[model samples]
Target: MSTSETTTMTAPNPAAARIPKKTVKDFKFIKEIGSGSYSTVFLAIESGTNRELAIKAVSKELVTRTKKISQVFREKDILALLTDCSYAVKLYCTFQDERTLYFGLTYCPNGDLLQYITDAGHLEEEVVRFYAAEIIEALEQLHNRHIVHRDLKPENILLTDDMHIQLTDFGSGVIMDNNDSPPQSNGTKNVDEEKKPIKRTNSFVGTAQFVAPEILKRGAIHVGSDLWSLGCIIYQMTTGKHLFRGHHEYDIYNAVARVSYKLPDDFPPLITDLVQNLVRLEPSERLGSEETGGMEKLKSHAFFSQFSYDTKWGNLLNQRSPLETKVKLSSRPKLSNDELETMSSGFDDRVEARLIGLRMASDAPNGIDAIVTGSSNISLSNETSSLHETDNQSTLSDQSSTKSMYNSPSSNSSFNNNAPVIARRLQMPDHALSLSEQASKNVYHKFVQNNLIIKQGILDKKKGLFAKRRMFLITEGPAIFYVDPDAMELKGTISWTADLRIEQKDMKTFLIHVPGRTYYLTDPDQDANTWCKSLISIHYRYYNTDPNRKLSTTTSYSSSSSSSAMQTIVPVTEL
Candidate 1:
């Protein structure tokens, strides 16, 4: 029997006909695990079987607003089709209500592959080979059914408890049949068409760095496109960086189109050869392309010579993963009823704060009095008066240093104690720019010029009673600044001195400690490790480059210290 026929005979169907009538009430939601543009995934317990499942709740209103109704249905259809595949996320059932649609999928307690990669910096070559082989098996199953997963990235590859891979997110996928003709060659196009420029798609889909050259060129997407993404993922697995990266999408597209990239000097020759063969500019020339020798050609490569699919494929799930020793799956904490309710509605306050430009404790000049109250109200008059008091107390040397730090000609003088404070109403920029653009222009130009911005992203800063969103920029000056992205105003800066330290409280929460104060911060993307690593790297870079910098006499705290040691350390009241 064919692979498809065997899969059909063995796997149980999870269609609407087989599933019983169910509703959202059938499951008890524990907490939200992940979210996307249109859907939020909640970790829930099935009441009947007491099984943990990840319930992807799609907002019907968002679907209608974004005109993605068809896309939602397509994902459901695709998930149902993949019920037989061990490497794909299994969908048990689907249900909907007045406001939301829910899909109950097998929950992977261990997080996505991105989190693992980020934590480890990069995987060992042996580990990379194991994961790559499983990914190839998954892709073979998809391609056998004529399904093309256009969006393939580490974030979409979830890890199970046993460290096995389960591919998810089929929203961007499409099915191709034998009747579909191959993409036309550049030379075959009409003369008039050749002269016209290639316009970008109205809504660009898929992650920019992993997208294939053919897809960027507006050519027909075939199975070869997936191999390109696989190559990119493998490269990143070996090196803690993207194969093709840029400050903007256009730059990444240009590099991909020209196949412009250099492997790291330390890259192993075997892995490098495998990646080069897979990411060829011409899809047909890729190692696994049908025109070439197909997947067997890739399987026979020296890099994967140790992994014999014929002997190992059936027992792959039983084998222990190499990452099993390195990564430990943490147990999820049980939440109280009040905590659950609070979390369900907690995001609304953030949205309102962003809309009205509510200043947090960190944003104010004095920082203490400007604390956002429980009601989310700020007393601007008191803050302004405090700013005036600070200006009167500033020394001549302090004033000069402040001026030199943030002397922008376009805006009112940068917020310093020596200047009269102006309450500028926050407004959107004239042209819309991505988050990276805003960071480059506002953070780089206004604060650290010439110094490299190591990392910048939105992080929630926990103040006295509430958490407020802020754009954080980490620079090579070994300095960290939290800014109001809307107003492009600098709020406060944290210098990464020798005494500064970081503590990871949990997956999302982390604490930064200076001499007297501790800053409680949380990453919405659950990348606390990345933030801590970047800050530590900057600190090392700064001290190593400048030999004359004196070390402080204050007691230094290590990140590996027990969390119990932080019990007495209070969150910073002032910036």
Candidate 2:
């Protein structure tokens, strides 16, 4: 999954006095359990409480100077309202002192649902149903309060030692309505009569692989978006894959807009029906809440024929007792002496120069009007659109600066303050780029298909089409991991993926597909012309002697990286 963009929650200082620095040594920093773009979560013994808690340590200064403080607050707000489930990770309390915001909460010893599924390859029907039922119940609670958990995917759902689920991370959730009034946009103001309007909304918000179709298209949507995402997750759980895994972000959004699901022959009947209904193109056509068949109504469908929400899961809504609130941290995300200096020297000359150039230019080819040349909103003309569709993307590319500023309505002060991540204009990183690169690198290294190559010691059966992931143990090629491929209209298998991690070197990992009964020479590059010929000869000497056999591996190796690589040839060992 792409790391959800984090918003800094640092309170602004009246004067730009230097922020104080902190050493992790202050709190009994326990095991470094996990990390994301803006924070690190540790399994620690909170001095406040004698119990083990998960401390989500985010650099308040990092997110704020970068400008996502309001987004951080939104996460806190969403977590606070959802003190409803045993399956949802309980957020004990959120408080801040200076450098870090400490969230005192329960630690799931079992990690997340991905580990369980990766360990088992796919989920059993009962398990998938039970979990889905739990999620549906949770969705009902969230929707009742007018909150939308925009990002719903497997990794965000945690698993306890007993294997029950606990959903965490509300960073991407949006409160659709506040105080019975229409919710305000996040710092987005009404378009000026003089200025051109921006296109669709974009965010480092939701993880793309599991994002709902409606969310991607920026269409009229509500909590049902979560159900569509739920359908994606459910399909992955039962079939070991996503229902409509796309090759790119635009592709993912495109598929979501259509709401079409392609099921494989091996998929279960009940699962097929359930996912299809959940992923219906029109939000009202899908299951749960206000659709033609409401969630309570859906509980009675044949796919859920064996289930009875009233007799079974309905009891969850009636529970009243709260888990004893034990630990609350007044600790805020802090900066270190050196980090403060690095942050203060935070201006990106490259980004500044680029923005300056854009500001000075007068000509924008007529159709690219919706987007501010280099923003996440792609330019799509209502008509006369490009025949050959391509993703012309750009990014905000500064250290921690936000240059675009517009005023909000006088009383509309409720939106988050997340700073846009700086990205390069022409060469920004694509979504799910990690999957393509990893597929190219790992598959290329192994002369043949070898699961052992990926597993040396890190083998897992739980990670699925949408969730299984591991770090690079060797600093070799692009980090690679497997996600199950889904059936698509075009042809063959299609799949989705999480992001590639590069900050750490020991994280290098990869994948390959070798035909059985045929010993073949490895194609460092997945080139078609040369690879097609390589498929015919069994002798390595043939490859060594012929200059015609050479081809680039750049394309075929990584969907994102290898334009030079070739796909594995169809089996014809008899030749």
Candidate 3:
């Protein structure tokens, strides 16, 4: 997932300032637990305390290169601020070396919600309610602090040994001023209300699958966006599939804008209702939007009515986790010294120049526009648009820092007060530049399909023929497509093709025959032949016909209001 652009390098209060810091040598590394483009998480044991912890190591060079130093500082500050909140991942301390910065965090023995969901396929209603309630509590704590957890997803929700969930990863969070008067629940200002326009930050961040409509539109985001993500997590837990499954960035964006998914009929009405309300297309109408009492409405939602909304939720720490892992966490792949070096080198002079722009910019931008470009295994391109500019500034670069200016005893007031102005023009990072081309391939290859195809096609998953022209990506998991690239409506799989068969429709088009649906795709005759060949290869790789190949059977169905019918089958054969 992408990290946040908002910058807060120091804690906002004295209590937060008191969080201790330890040297990296104070902990003994156990093994790698998690990894992303910018950082790596490891299991470690504190030498003096003999306590287990998860230590996230981030490359200082890479951070400086990507111009995300503010995000790093922001995460540290937020974690410290939430140290006493049991619902969030606790920050034990922080440490840094010349090369890397380290964050000592509470180790969740049961892994992340994503792992649990993968193991269980779909969680039972009771279990979903349990986790969702805890997540709501966490959000409440954050919202009360005027912080928006911009990155909320299963991967960021960690599980304690006793099955309780903790919200982690604040790198993508936004911290607003709590001193400001609250906006009306309707999120609109009356003419009689304060004349000051409500502060709204515009940035494109967070994972594609879980982004909210407001975020996708490249508009301003608020607490409501987090509620939308919560809805997605709940739906994913209940169905073992992302509410918005897309082939790539464009597809995910489309789903975010449309809110086209439907809850399974078997889902309790309350659960279905909660998900729908939370993910409403209109931000103000969302369950916890500013127009609402923020987290209060979320807590009182029907889906969580049965769960107690209190600190730690009473005795959850002693309860057994709903999902269990058979293998030791240390079994995850470890990074080699050479791999680490390569990751560290991901940033260059251009990247550092961008960081300078972010740190020095004065006139704050209103919206973020992205142009993904890069060749490495990891990179994302992002650009900020100034409200004053008629034409978008080309090539994305991190925007100005929102350094918090506080008078806490430990505050570095001088640095915060006199922050530099970011440069007007900057280039996007390489990984960001390649997000469209690489992120899909990387995420799908590692977690979903080992192979996939990216191209234009029509998706008739729920609408039958004449569905809008779209881009289709066929992976091992599903045939994901996008009806509206920016809106992010994930047109789900229309058929399971055992094999791909192409029939010529005309000189400008060809028909692809899959298991249950035949798609007529338009392409020049020359390219049509290649498209057919590639589609066949992709399908064959997914459902290998090798005689020695093992067979697995699993029933699948969609709950979209347009297609509620179900089917069961046995035996594996040709499409």
RMSD of each: 14.4, 21.6, 22.2
Candidate ranking under lDDT, highest first, comes to 1, 3, 2
Please report how far candidate 2 places residue 220 from its true position, in Å: 3.0
* Candidate 2 wrong stretches, greater than 4 Å: 1-27, 180-204, 307-311, 315-575
Runs of candidate 3 with Cα error greater than 4 angstroms are: 1-16, 178-202, 306-575
Q: Residue 143 of model 2: what lDDT?
A: 71
Pick the TM-score winner: 1
Kindly list the per-residue Cα lDDT of model 1 for residues 64-148, writing each as its tens digit. Answer: 6555565666576667777888889988978887777889898998988888887788998878988988889889888776667
- In candidate 3 the C-alpha lDDT for residue 550 amounts to 18
Ranking by TM-score: 1, 3, 2
Top candidate (lDDT): 1
Q: What is the C-alpha lDDT of each candidate?
A: 0.62, 0.44, 0.54
TM-score of every candidate relative to the true structure: 0.60, 0.51, 0.55
Tens digits of lDDT, candidate 3, 1-575? 22333323432545456878788667656555555545767777666466788988887765765566767776776787787787899888887877778888999876777766765677888788877877877787787776778789987888776567899888877665436565444543333332222222334678777888766775554678888899999898888888886434555677678887767778778878888888888878888776765666677776666754442344455555444333244233444545433332212344334432432221112211110111111111122111111111111112422121111222421122112111111123332334344444333323212222333333222121112334455432224333333334443343443333444322234455443444545531123433443443333333332111112223232433112111111122211
